[model samples]
Target: MYKLCHQQQVDNACGFYAGHHMLVIAGSKNIRKPEDIVLSTGPLDDWALAGLRESLAKFIMSEVISSKGEFHHPTATY
Candidate 1:
């Protein structure tokens, strides 16, 4: 997962990677407030959140295919 996200240069790769691949949904209990005022607008709106969900689903599908031992590095295509 780290390799996958690192290849894409994603920030907070660990959490985002897990979110993309995990079958069971995970939530954070830490709930720290955002330091940036831009984030103070609250959670993402429905449309934006839906787009994220779609991306996660696509990632999971790709992982499932790669897990069949078809690719040496599953993230190589990215």
Candidate 2:
């Protein structure tokens, strides 16, 4: 089992490779309106980016509950 650590031993084991890593973001887009925004994945894997899109899906496109607690159908546009 792999337990996530809080870098307790990081300071003690600081090595040359520690400063060699770099973070990169693939691509980004600015939406004209927050509500008109739709996120799509590129040919890459990023945990942070993927999780962010999934979390925001509900807010971007969601159905409202009526008096009967039934979901409303969202009309699609061409």
TM-score to true structure, per model: 0.33, 0.22
lDDT of 2 by residue, 26-58 (tens): 222453544443332222234644555564455
lDDT of 1 at 3: 22
After the best TM-score superposition of candidate 2, give how far the Cα of residue 19 lies from its true spot, in angstroms. 27
Report every candidate's CA lDDT.
0.43, 0.34
> Compared with the true structure, what per-residue lDDT tens digits does model 1 show for residues 28-54?
234353221122123334575466678
Give the range of the ten consecutive residues with the poorest summed lDDT in model 1: 34-43
lDDT score at residue 34, model 1, on the 0-100 scale: 28
Clashing pairs in 2: none
Alpha-carbon lDDT of model 2? 0.34
For model 2, give the 10-residue run with minimal summed lDDT.
Answer: 16-25
Relative to the unseen true structure, what is the C-alpha lDDT of residue 12 in candidate 1, on a scale of 0 to 100?
Answer: 50
